[model samples]
Target: MAAKPNTVNPAQKKKQRAFEGVCKSLIPFARAAAVIASVALLLFLTPFVGIYNKDIPGMEITVGGFSAALCALSGQFTNVGAAFGNMDIFNHFAPAHCKVLAACAAAAALCLLAALVLCVVLAIGKAPGLHSAAAVLQALAFAALIVSFAFALAMSGTRLLPEYCSGNPACSVRSLAILPALAACAGCAVNFAAALRYRKAKKNI
Candidate 1:
């Protein structure tokens, strides 16, 4: 008796080919977009949103966002309170809850940096392992941002010294603080989506 000849299913082969084609066509664009978004996120977090301080005449204290390293306007005062691991000037003067907010902000910043590095690697390399790594990093970054934003809201809602704000209208949380996290989240979404596509394409192929 003769054994049956090996065979391939035409329909399945066509479907797999089509899927691979789509993935190949779109993966590069997706990766590029993710890179752009990640860079934007880094820029937002670095110089723009980390601190916002406004000093006016006759105001004794400067008020603004509390960060882990230093206060927003540390330059204005002689002693800006303790450095990293402790409250800055803003946190010292504002409510205790500001410490929690500062910590969350710091964590988010670190996560964003990690995500940025992973994104750059993903864009440069096409290895299957790298894609998965990027996906996980982006997800973690997103979670960190969520926590940071939550703490920020809590600090803001409680009112960072109502008396200070009432007297000094210039002293307030800058809206820019939230923009970086938002942009970072957007970047994470793009990178994760691209990773998923790449994985699917590999599996299909």
Candidate 2:
């Protein structure tokens, strides 16, 4: 009698192939979003003065950094607010907005640093034998950023962009700041879309 022939399971093979595809598509979108978000947040570090001063640009920075930070910490939100008091740059603005911006700046900085970590994790995750939850968390993190950024922008509209203050409410609000804020609105939209897609994919998984 001939030895029993070995058999390969076709259904199992198909499932494996599908899982591989899901894994491949998973992080690319998340990484791309993370990179763009990182760059956008880091861009806020540009000297915010003169014609470009607006909470929107700053908002983008804050949001981007925040999303990145979540990815960095493996989806944990850490408090680093008091750390802003140690920075000299925060000393250069109106007392009220300065404190607000300083706190925002510190948080954004921490988040951007986190993005860098996410970048590495994402890149290395493609190798064989690496397990990562970041691809899933990236969407959630960015989603939180979108919601928070919108809330912050709305809140600041009634408050004031740093450039609008002359140490009193009597000062005129600058028209120039409106453009950056508008630009930030666009960024927020993009962030929201990314978050939606991320959430949808996560649900499917």
Candidate 3:
């Protein structure tokens, strides 16, 4: 006797169609997740930075974002004569506000992590309904990160706390610091492009 060909039942066929639809709907979310991860990691590469003198090369006293946030939030560094966010240099009371920016960076990290998880679930699991929330979280993270960078660069007289730097004719910025700032700028540009593309794709969905 000839063997009969195996066939999928109607129920199985319907389940497969549903699965395929779910996966297709998640393509945009996967793209956003990749962009979000790249942006978040790039921002984290920036030092939670400060320095005593800008004249010398490789002399900035930089710390990690999480460590700086913790120290600032808990007032632990105050006892060590490091009064953060309040400093005087070059006859100017420059409020660096590093404490606040550190906190923002920490909060952004949390948002990024949450968004990444949501994106993964929506892309891999059957949770397309969470797409909007995930996108919103990623946007928030990106905004907060940008705000932190802007805070560092705005009206500081330099790349970071030029007022705090004191030396024999200290310049506004150091040569070494410029490299990281430029790299961060490129990362921001890439992230912005990805966001625009995502928005356009979202409208089609």
Candidate 4:
């Protein structure tokens, strides 16, 4: 006689279904968690940035440009020193005239973190609209980062601020600019990864 065939009983089937449901629920969240972890690592490595320059104005063009942008966006740069939305908006004062540059850098870090998380969630969700938007935002962020790197280099090389180099150790504005540039690069990288993941997920699906 032949052996009895194995069967998936009703209870076993129900348990399997439940397990699958849990996995489906966790997939998006797990991707989100990974994005957050990456952002956190960047934050931990970022130095505690001070006012763009405590010493001189001309040597702080990068900081000044950041301040002017913040000031224009928020209307008062110094009020928001070292924090978000605090810079004066009119660009009346060059980046060196205000303390808002540091604030803008901090804000950029937060925005990039948010962007990373959003991109990861959108990718895992496999939403076409969200993924497209993330890709666009990532591109813009990359562009901004590139421009920032250029400005930083320009400021570091200019001889406008002799005081910056007069210190015992003689620090350059590049010293300050380098940190934000690195942070911006990290943001661009993560956003790009998220976009790729979104594309891959779409293809797989």
Q: Give me the runs in candidate 1 sitting further than 4 Å from their true place.
A: 1-34, 37-87, 94-96, 157-159, 166-172
How does candidate 3 score on lDDT? 0.50
Off by over 4 Å in 4: 1-72, 75-114, 123-129, 157-160, 163-169, 175-205
The TM-scores, one per candidate, come to 0.59, 0.43, 0.56, 0.44
For model 1, which pairs clash?
A: none
**Model 3 CA RMSD to the hidden true structure, in angstroms:** 8.2
TM-score of 4: 0.44
Best by TM-score: 1
Model 1: per-residue Cα lDDT over 60-117, one tens digit each? 3322223332432233222444333223434544444454555545555566656666
Count backbone clashes in candidate 4. 10
Q: What lDDT score is found at residue 120 in candidate 1?
A: 57
How well does candidate 4 score on lDDT at residue 58?
A: 35
**1-205, model 2: which lDDT tens digit per residue?**
8998888788766766765565555455445545654665555433322212343442221223223233234322333443221122222322343334334434544444454465446444453112123333333334443443343334344434344353343332221222323333343344345445444544453
Task: Give the poorly placed runs of model 2, Cα more than 4 Å off.
Answer: 1-9, 47-93, 127-205
Best of the two (1, 4) by lDDT: 1
TM-score of 2: 0.43
